[model samples]
Target: MKLIIISGRSGSGKSTALQALEDVGFYCIDNLPAPLLPDLVNQILRDPDHPNKLAVSIDARNQHSNLKQFPDIYKRLRETRRLDCEVIYLDSSETTLLQRYSATRRKHPLSDDSQGLQQAISYEKQLLEPVSDLAAIRIDTTRLSLYELRDSIKLRVARRQEQELSLQFESFGYKHGIPLDVDFTFDVRCLPNPYWVPELRGYTGQEQPVIEFLEQQPEVQQMLADITGFLEKWLPLFEKNNRSYITVGIGCTGGQHRSVFLSERLAGHFRATMDNVQIRHRELN
Candidate 1:
């Protein structure tokens, strides 16, 4: 059986992620008690009619003592021979979470007469630290739209095969702030700048003119080769460590040219040998 644990602070789109998994045929449960997890798994195993794909959402709504015991419970769940368990933690910036609450007019679960929304938001992070520390995948939803989040859950979680590693290459602009989810970040601002060229300034790296301009620069090719070689040497080690997913971030000045070009190149190179490789350009999206 495959078990996916969805967790995070409230208003971080945990419901959307659970729904996405449900849509893909996962038998999903929301706000399950942490201590009851072992019983749930045993029940599912005993029943042949029960779905093999199980997803459960565990969060601050549960009792404090139950949340504290999550690590020990999780350790035992992972030891179950027939079970494949993965935890996906979703989070957003404090400012974004505050804005979301203000826009929607929804009361936070932790807020009360003594606690304001901001205070509740801050406290919830501390309460959920035990679960967050064990997460295999962490997603920052500060900038992602609902559709984007749903697509991410579908592609990155639901579609991944058991025991397979999913690799993602994302390109972003340095000025916009680095992506919080990437495991590795490479800055390519030192390479040639297509934004300075008069004609290429109007096009992105995915376009033919910008692509042609970047292709001619020896510095760009050399950087791509070096980055590729580094990943080739170390990626197998990550796989050996049982990592389910890895994200590589490539950044340039505007995320329009160099970063996009190299991200596409790297994805192409890896896709030839790997079954699951995905690329996304943050600024372009």
Candidate 2:
């Protein structure tokens, strides 16, 4: 089994990271106390039908002060079980953590009458250093958006999947919002706003009327022509550069109409020719 121990500071998005792991198919346990790790691993190893990927979260909530216990447990587990273990350390700046605490209106785990959240955070950081240094992957969540963080975890998990060229196309609307996780963005407002047409306002480009309208417009034709040419020229280059995935985002005004249609069309285009492509309408109503 692949054992992943996710550890980090209190407000560094450890819960979010664990949820991301769970989303990607890992059997996840949240707030697992450090001292019980060895016994848990032993039980799992004894079960032949155990899950292939297992993730457990360890943090300040655990009363294990002997920081040395984690490495020792890991060494012993490695010797006994056919397990590959990796530690993922999630961390963020004190200022960001303080902001998170204030936003959530939650008291810090280590804070007391004399010490503030900042002080508590500092204390926890020192206490967790031994395990943090043992991490194979250390991620600073200070600047990471939730989607970006999830995508990062997915990328790591995807490494175990067969090595294949993958592409993800996402569609969104600027008014509803831009896709935060897009690697490349294309603005379709240049074509036409389907929102303007009273009849097509509620309909998406996946329908016949919207497709016919878009196909008739000179600008739409030109835009698709140019983008298709660009993809023909650049996709091979992306492969040459050793990229496993490329996300192309298409956006318009309202997510329900134009962007949805264009995204569907773009996905269909890639589906006919590309090797591996996953498409999602991020802001589709």
Every model's TM-score: 0.98, 0.56
lDDT per residue (tens digit) for residues 160-278 in model 2: 44335566666777875555446678898877877799998777777888888887888887777777788778988877854545677788876666667666767778878765666
Worst 10 residues of 2 by lDDT: 156-165
How well does candidate 1 score on lDDT at residue 108? Answer: 96
Q: Put down candidate 1 lDDT per residue, 81-118, tens digits, no spaces.
A: 78999999999999999999999999999999999999
Clashing pairs in 1: none
Top model by TM-score, which number?
1
Q: Residue 170 lDDT in model 1?
A: 94
| Candidate 1 residue runs with Cα over 4 Å from true position | none
Deviation in Å, model 2, residue 133 alpha carbon: 1.1
